[model samples]
Target: MFILSGLFCIPTDWHVLIITFMNAKVESWCARPEQLSDMPVSTWKQLSGQVNQTCQIKNIDWDAVTNETDISGEFGMKDCTKWEYDDSQFQSTIIGDFDLVCGRDVLIDFAQTIYFVGMIFGVLTFGILADILGRKSVLIILLLFACLTGTITSQMPNFTMFAISRVVNAFFIIGIFETHFTYCIELVGGKWSTIIGMGMEYFWVIGWLILALLGYLIRSWRSLTLLISLPSLSAVFMIWLLPESPRWLIAKGKLDQAEKILREAAIMNGKPLPDEWKLKPVKDFENTKKTTIFDLFRTRNMRGKILILYYNFFVTAFLYYGLIFNIGDLGGDVFVNFAASGFLEFPAYGAAIFVLMKCGRRIPYGTSLILSGLFLLSVSFVPRGVYYKDWPCMVLALIGKTCVTFAFGALFVYAAELVPTEIRTSAIGSASFLGRIGGTIAPWVGKLSIYHPYLPVTIFGVNALIAGLVSFLLPETQGQELPYTIEESEKLELASLIAPSILKPAKSTQPMEQEMIEFNNIPEKVEENEEDNLSCYSGDSALSQKVCS
Candidate 1:
């Protein structure tokens, strides 16, 4: 089920990311008026004195100059109402098809911005629904509609319909990702959660690579959209293949269903459930208070953590998507650059997994963000003469992209571990909700290049630096079990505060080593209890053991 859930990443990621190509700015110039119809394009430019201008044409009467040559003089320029595009690279893009250039250029960014706005609502709404309706149902519903809406997006006859369909598609795309993330995490709750969570990004990278290939091959925005959208219909088969999250079922007091699923899993693994062990409701669930988004903010410690996570998530999305959307401006083949960017993420994710295990969550997460910022800042400083440009800036951007990708993959695991299971989906939803706000702003920020070439990177770099610093304020959840309730999550925050002192050496290194050994045995002691033993099936004990190993 976990592996199958990961497969959905390909289509979901493509749907969300294809916008980078769809709205790409193609080379364009002001169209010649009817009077200049007989003139060659180069002659028209020279005759009208409109060289190097995209949005303006010289306001000169050509009737008097019809028979004249060399009638050159300065003239006032007028904003171009119609444009022609160079279609050598892309046969058609939204920018060309809709004439989204110059004054209308911001609308290109606006389309992506509104898509992310829909993502904000998608995560929040579907997150709560996943928590209530069960993960399987939510995943199936999202997949079906996401595919449908994405296909409709390609058929939209006008910009208004295109934007509307994209918004709806974004809604389902984000929901599919969030719901699947929550489902996969819950399905494999033990030490494997980190691997499962971060590993999901590998599938995303696969989709990204394919997107680059598709974009290069198709060259038309509409066809590319149709190609990416149609394949997602295959994911609808998950209805039968996917199971309801056992952890969620138990939380909702449906023990029979939860037990049946657990038993099936145990049998498949050839580790039969112990007759003595039985399914039990989590003690936190019996209170009947109903988990809401407020539960995340109900306590002081969790509130601080959630807020910091929100900012980190915002920074992650801001820099990550900003860099991706600006691939065309990076001075290379857009397809190659996009593919290279995706390829570099493999190593980044590998490094993220290694550091997450060795350094724990907080240090590596914060450090990656800082490093990503530094690299982005360096991109602006690279000498910009013809001899020292392009490749250097591209190299720096790629490095920054790698670091941010590390942070991006790590943040998912870190955020999932921080929130308790009862409201886990909702909490992640809310964090992503805030993150989408940053994503919404990223396209507009990408447009800042018109003012200054380095302005966008500079802004992204500075924000990443601040966010990196803010990440240290968050508690680390590297070796700890996934919190099952609000109180457990709060206790994690409190424990993180005193953990250093608690493990402080009294005198010799030998004693500290011994203390570490004893500390590692704590879960073993907890496992002796029947109530606590049930956690093994749910993945907590297995996760703790894996972390320690």
Candidate 2:
């Protein structure tokens, strides 16, 4: 069921790339007046005297021009009142449909920024709601609303309505992403957590690949959007098929509900529930204070961790989306380049999982960021006019994409591991909110190429380097257990500082039992009656054992 829920990533991830095609630039020029309708296009261009211009045409008196042989002299240029577009590349797009050319071209970027702004709100709003309302209910709601908004987006008659629908669609899309991510993470533990967390990114890459194909085949933006959105309607039925997170149920003091879910899971796995097992709510579940984003900053150690996480998230989204949006400027077939970008992520994610499991999270993640920065920075120095220059630039950019993809996958698992379960979604949402801010600015920064082609890449590269350096300050969570509370998280930080080399699994050994018992405040006498002690403790025995260890 958890794996099936990952299908939501299709529309969510496809929306991110569809913007590239939706606002694609097409060949356009000032429309000839009705009086010159009989003239050849070549003759019309000669008269206009602004033949090369897309947004302006020379002020020409069509009534005075009687002969096609009459060549035009230089005339004052004027803003084009009407435009004609060539449909060779794109049959229709927001750019051509809305005449977002010349002075109004920036609206394309503005619309994308608005979409990301909505994503920021979605992450925060849905993250909190998932914790309070339960992940299952929130996900079902988001899926239904996302489908509705996405369908409405296709029927918008004007740019204003289109933008409004897109922003609202973006809101629900991110909500589904965050709620689903939190629920999936809560379902498993230990090595499975790493596998599930990083592995889920593959679905995102698949969506990207499929979007490239769809963009190539469907040249009309409205039709393409409707096609991609229809699949989500099927996912709305997940309310009946999906189960609530047992972990979240336990946290909310719904012991019976959690037990029922766990028992079913055990049965599905062909492993019967142990006769001695019991459902126990976390200690103080009723009295526990609700955690919010502010709680992440309450402790000195957590504050430092979250600050570094924010910067890393910002740089990741900035560089990732910046590179994607800039693909049109890479001097090649945009569809082919887009496909290559998505294809490279497969190996990148594979490499990420391998390294994350073997080498831990901090070093590999930080190094990937630094390496990607170097690749991006190198693209500027590859001589521009050389016959092979475009190839080198494309190669470097694709390599950077791979590196950044690796870093992105690793960061998701790492961030989830660092934050405690109680405030996990909120903390992830807060960090992701910073990422959306960076994503919002990426389009405008891509526009900086008008002044200097390398300016945006240089900025992305430098920010990545700085973020990579800061990432090392975060403690390694490679073999460590997921922290359930602020105090537990702080202990992991202190342990990393003190014993830096000892990387052990969370399972308790005889020698570590005393430390775990003291940390969890369990009486020594409880060790004599392990079965009774498990029943009295909060959360699952695995979690209690982790705490004890």
Candidate 3:
């Protein structure tokens, strides 16, 4: 069952990297800029190659445009509208097939931006729906439509059709991925939360590496599109193997359904339930006031957590996606650059796992953000006089990428742990919605590079710096039980920023060590009532035991 949900992360993560590669394809049909110069006739043939063979000849007075823009010594600048593209570079793409070059370049960004716009809708629609509808059912429905719209997007005749279909595809696919994340976390006991969450992120790293390989092998945009979308076919079969989240069912008052799933799980694990054993909703969790989105902001503690976490989500998406979209422009073999960037994430996630367990979530999560921001800012200062300027710049970028990847992997579990169980999906959904706003803005950052190369990284660095500083204010959740209700969440103590953790208790921090000792000294008791029994079977207790072990 642990492996089953891990398998689900592959396709969802692939969708994120796939669209990044898709931008490479769709934007492939850029206008082949022409150099209008007064070079000798014989020099023209020498300078022109396969890329510029199809260039349109335009007669313009060289003196008239001399001060208007910088004209190259080899090729003077000419209007893109009058230029023709080299077909050898791009055989087919939405940009190529529809001749969407020059003035229409924004469409490429539009196509990419709209997907995140759709993701905003997906997060909103599915976040609440996952809570209302069973996570498994809503996920399946989303998967079905994701496959359909993805296929339709591949076959679109024009940019409008492709953009529209992609928007719809993104809406459902992003929803499925986010909902499945919530489902996977809920499916596990809390003890395995970091492992399960980070393990799934490792799959996302694998998906990016796979996309790089596929993008290399499949040159045509449409072919690559279809190849990536093909996995959605397996989503149907995967659906049959998945189970409704018992936690969600319990939350929604579906005890019979929840019990059936739990019993089957127990049977599969060879730990048969007692003959008298019966599962029911926890009494304290029942008849809780109906939660609304406003509930997140209604309380003082929650409002701060919600706002800070929301910004963290935004910063995470901003830095992560911004770095991804800029990879192609980094001056290397696009394929190698993409693959190398993806490769660094493997160790990043591994490091994240280590730090999250040993150092606790708040310090590691915040430190990673700070380090990534510092690295990103430092890239602009790489000495131009160096023999290999590009290498230093790329290394700095990769380091920043690695740090953000580590932060993002841990951020999901951190966010999940901070929010209460009942409204967990909605909280995640809202955070994701804010994250997509940053995602939507990422493509525009690439555009900012034209004004100044460092401008985009500067914006990313600033956001990351703010987010990292704010992370210190968040309560740490490592070695703590997940709260099941708003009241329980409210009772959770805010770990002092300067206080030493149990894992690294300072000499002055006797209170933290004493608290840990007291918590451990508490003896476990057998279930004597329905509520006690429910807590044992609810997965949280099992998770805590796993953590202790």
Candidate 4:
């Protein structure tokens, strides 16, 4: 409980704080005309004289200019004349407008994206470690490292140091996230999977609220970071409240320990286990064979499927993070912008609850992405001065934001549903890795837009369009029970979906075609071969012979 709550408050702040601080700096730089390029020395002398003349008019001594190098202990002015009476050099920083900095934000944006890239690698590597050692073991290692390294990042003396620390911290925290997702979901039953999965997202909102309150109080970016680290101090105690997942224990062949944990859960829920609830050694462990990373591409459909996943995930991350990081540049007070954004998300969340509960997953998931792309493109050309209303641009930006937000929520659930249990996390994590690169590219995309105003939005719109079309490449998982293995997943016309999408079978769906999509209408069933091949996790392929300890 504490670890989740504590670590939970960290990243949401990371995302919003940088944009807020940088935006302010960018505007301050632009307000002074000194940084403007191409102003001749004669123009400079004129502006300087004009300023000095103002001092004369006011009959007050103009404040004596201080040397910037004297204050910062760097950058000697070898060509002293360069600083002389030059109005263009008068601005204190690089780039004038916050929007221009938004245009130039390649450096900081890459840092942010690379941080998430580290997370994808972390999931893959630590997932293996979690299986080899215990989940609790890996969690402890990652959390301690995360708390230590993550706080140190705030105190980094330079951008390079900060970037390196951020990646290190990203690696650790993501390991914790991957472990926690599987652990918490297992402790409850499979029936509660959606609740456990979706419920955790509320922590993200909690982090945002804390950030808003902290932003109100601290304001300074570094101090806000210090506040984020405060939560980590309480994590050690909070994690002790819940027991390890009973299912994880059973997978390790620890029937006694699994039973103990299950009994404790029953006691907590105030219910008794039925006779069939008793733990027994699973015979499904028979014939468990070794699987490798290469196995993912060995089969014809599998190779093509991986390619499509790579495509889907890459585009998903690119569009999602790009839009999020650049939200302020659409033009507004960032605090108000961030707040309105948070408020707008309520409708998205409400829609998720409604759709997942009543209508099921397929349409809402696909529609969210399709509409997201369309709305974004609609905003792309929203002229600064419309035919009638000048406010049309801002209105379009807000609408684009809402559409993307809803799709962001949809993608998380949608990805979890696509693959059979055999390789779900690996597929998702591998895709996320590519996506993180897209995320890394996002800030640069935003920066590119500073030079080319419509660049980032158009790029984002294109990706959303592709991802929306590719949604059909994935089979609709609505009524089917979560397939526990490749055999089960294949038994459904998995080939049918894959065939349409391949570079061969991936199902690259056009919007109209998605509505016409249908299942093979086979018996609502799990194949016998699939049930017999239960060597992997209930939802992802985390094991070959047995669930790792």
What's the CA error at residue 395 for candidate 1, in Å?
3.7
Q: Give candidate 4's error at residue 148 in angstroms.
A: 0.8
Candidate rank order under TM-score: 2, 1, 3, 4
- Candidate 4 on 245-313: residue-level lDDT in tens? 454455455678766665565455554433333445443556765333455576766566567667766
* lDDT (Cα) of model 4: 0.52
Native-vs-model 1 lDDT? 0.76
Predicted candidate 1 versus true structure: per-residue lDDT over 1-549, tens digit per residue = 666677765788888778778977678878866666767778777666667777787776545556454666777887877888888888889998888888887788788789998898898999999888988898888888877998898888888989999889988889888888888777654346677778888888888898888888899999888888887788767767777887677667787887677667656655555555565566645556887779888878888888988888888998888887774465567788678777888999888777776667777888899998999999788767665447778877878888899998999898988887778888899899988998888867877889998999999999989998877767766656666667767875633433463232112111111111112222222244454444332222532332221
TM-score of each: 0.84, 0.88, 0.82, 0.71
Better of 2 and 4 by lDDT: 2
Model 2 spans with C-alpha error above 4 angstroms: 34-43, 61-76, 274-276, 449-453, 494-549
Query: Residue 313's C-alpha lDDT in candidate 2?
Result: 92
Which residue ranges in model 4 land beyond 4 Å of their true spot? 1-19, 22-106, 131-136, 187-191, 274-277, 280-286, 291-294, 301-306, 328-332, 387-390, 419-424, 450-452, 489-549
Decoy 3 TM-score against native: 0.82
lDDT of 2 by residue, 439-507 (tens): 888878977889998898899889888898788777777656666666667775622433444343332
Q: What lDDT does candidate 4 reach at residue 330? A: 40
lDDT of 3 by residue, 347-435 (tens): 98888877776777888899899999999899788765574556877778878988999999899999887887677888889899999
Better of 2 and 3 by lDDT: 2
